[model samples]
Target: MTKVQFRTAEERDRAQWADKFTAVAEGNLYRDKNSPFPIHEYFKLGLLGKEVRMLELNAGAALVDHMVADALTELNISSETEGNADEIKDWHKSIFYQDTLEQTARSFFSCGYAAQQVVRDIDPDTNENTYTIITLNSKTWYPTVPTFKYQEIREGRVVSIFSENNDGVKSWYAFVERHTKGNVEHELYKLENGNDLEGTKLKIKDLDRFKELEDSVATDLNHIPIFQIDMTRGAGKYFGQSIFAKIWGNLQEISEIKTQMRMERIKHFRSLLAAPAQSLQRAQRVDDGEALPNNSKQARVEQYEHQATFDLRQEIMAVPPGAQMPQFIQRDLEIITKAMEMIRDCLSEIASVTGCPRSVFNLDEKGTIHVETEKKKDRKYVQRITQCQKKLEWITEQGAKTYFQWKGDKAGKKEITAELDSAFEMTLEEKVDLYRKMNSDGKFISQEEAVRNLFPDMTEEERTEMLQKIQDEDKSLAGSFGDPVPVEL
Candidate 1:
């Protein structure tokens, strides 16, 4: 008999939530053939007892992607101070912070939380320290219960564990990385059996298989190197709640309705010919008074039915004398129309829950979205995005600080800051028009100020160079036109 280890409540809950949200985010709701959900009916469709592909309306993916795109569009990260700003920008580019930032946001929105580990190493060519950010799989990474003060989470520790399975090996290895303030720990253990339970407490028998593969190692960094982003925080909750959880019911309803409509179409779209049995039998008889054998009569009736069906596909068909004409059954489309209406309603609810506009998901059948209404609803979403932006900014600053700390650059560490653009802000054209109008009215201080307003991401050095280039261009144009004619006042 094989002994089984059960998962702890915390682990079980996290696993369930992660699986549910992941399925929705990845549009795999019906991947499980035995799923009890109504959406599974979509995948159960069969022709001649063989299952066929079914329609899937993945509203969850649409919602998550739309919000994430809105939040992270035109994202710009930079140092807040002039000190080492250029170096920090270069570091961001070297580490591909933009891509990492988008990945982190996607994970956070889809999985309720995201974790990243900062790795510091030496560059082989320059022998200088290098820093890179690595996004961790939410399922493989666990955070300890956070320290709380006055009903708020102050800090938390993280542990990243993954299993390594070697080919042709019965047993596997587990690698664990633990991060805490001022120290990082690494451990490797070999499991005698492959049944070591993950995200659960170990039993005595399970512990017996845990053989140390190497001595434990610890690194002191004076700061926690793992950065985490949580979608929403609640009191005493270790992990945040996924957005999918709130809108899952609506998504499932939409998918089920879509599946139902698809099934209806498959069943009703074909032209079904209806005729009296007598007509078919009469058409099969060679002569009106000819008496055929029972077996032959049945066979002739079936053959005549098949022929009639095939003939119905043509523009005209000839029927036997005294035989009734077959009439085509009309399909009722009211059910499909109602299903579409229900889907639109569910989309509206999802939009409200997600703090996004219904237009994003094409829920508006009128093809027009109310701008003011959308903007009003988007305010709360914008605030949420701003909060996430701040967290990402903090993460970037922390990573830069860690890099500088490893390099022994105390000033750089102290001066590093990160900035991100608000996705909901005014458009570039709108800003340009406003600035141009202000400058025309003499409300502006100088051209530099206008330039700063237009391009806030540019460094002071870059701004100076840009202004000089403009001035040199103006001088060249003036020279090209020759000296201006002197006019007496």
Candidate 2:
């Protein structure tokens, strides 16, 4: 098979999807600004109620991840006899679960897309099959060709690349080097000026060395292992459209509403802090009265201002006779209260648009969803989880096949399995009740089957032991003349 020049495609695809990528990046920024990380340090003080370093509300971003995480229940995988069901199940429990695929799915939901690639290899010393899973963030994934289907990326000649500086190191190193020479530490050192070697001035000869060093980093960066791009694309028109993307307008509206509310609050505080409008009693002038002591009206007004500061509730000014008092104006707090109402409405709307229940947003609405209505919501999200399962199924199958091939299995047969029963909805009590109903009137459900349904986390050995105990008890009871008491189903 001819090798595809993936490097060329990476450059081409990055440019092709430049606009969309920009939008995703900006959307992520806006999300962080509105929810967790404040767009500015000062903004945090204004919105979050305190001034601190590196603070943001970040609710908008977290809302997306939380909704997805809460909805995901469990993943069950199994395969045919050729697939080594026991080993596959063990792998699912140990390796797959260790990868925290559900958390990765949360990322996919948050970022509009996420990717996983399967790699197969052998342990040379032990001659045992091994697998490697590569998870990619949205930023690193670029499709060279346009493909609507997530699993059909290979046909589109896609390439996923992750790049980072090595702190002047030449080659790529795994695990330990990740901490000593990886991007994070390097950035920290740069920020702290640790990279500045004192008294080490660069000479002309160093230019060549610097250039060589850069070239070496570039060479190491280009060596990306290509993989098939599989995303849990659930009802999204395109891979770039994240759960947050569709409801971005609403999130933005909520963000704006929050900002406005904060301003209104500030306004209210200022009004409270300020002195209240006072009723002034103007002085009346009598032409026949003794001549005033060269006192001007302006002098009289200043005297009244000085007296008022010392606890004068009302200002009494000496004015010409027949002076009319100005109409009293009251502070109208209703506008601020009305703004609060607007904010509540915006929050409810945001929750509605994002498919999140209003309760999640902490709205005060007393409405409750009907049982059937809730089931519909559950079904909608369950379908999303199923779509993600399909992607995982493909990934696991390919990985298994590769593992068998490395072991010289001619057929190279394998299957990746997934089971998301009832969308993670069975309580122990519920399962037990159902089992009792199923076993009533000689309609017996096997102990193993009942255990499997009730406690999926139980191992086969544990289930077997429990089953044996039940069987032994039944035999002991049968030996007596009375009918054997039935074991709990």
Give the candidate number with the greatest lDDT.
1
lDDT string for model 1 (1-489, tens) is: 343332245764575567567667767776553231343432456542355454466888887777677667554444555657687778778888788888777778888888777886668799986788887767666555555522332233333333544585454544455556565555444444423544233422343334432233334466567776786767776677787867878887888788778777876877588765444432333454655566687769856665654333444445667777878786788999898878877888887887876767764545333343344335556555655665676677777777777667644545665656656556788656645654686533357766765788898999999999988998899897897768899
lDDT (0 to 1) per candidate: 0.64, 0.47
Off by over 4 Å in 2: 1-63, 92-99, 119-130, 146-151, 155-240, 266-340, 351-379, 403-410, 424-489
Q: What TM-score would every model get versus the actual structure?
A: 0.67, 0.49
Q: Tens digit of lDDT per residue, candidate 2, span 1-489?
A: 222122343444433343233333334433332232225545545654554223123346556554555545555557656547666666556565536466456555666566554444457799975666556544444444435544343312222222245687432111100111111110011111211111222221333222322211111111123333233345644454456555655555555556665565556565422233343433443332555445899667666764554332445533345555444344566776776576566666666665665655554344333232232233334445545544444555555554444445545455545444544455577557656665566333456666776777888899888889989898877777476658997
**Worst ten in a row by lDDT for model 1:** 149-158
At residue 249, candidate 2 shows an lDDT of: 57
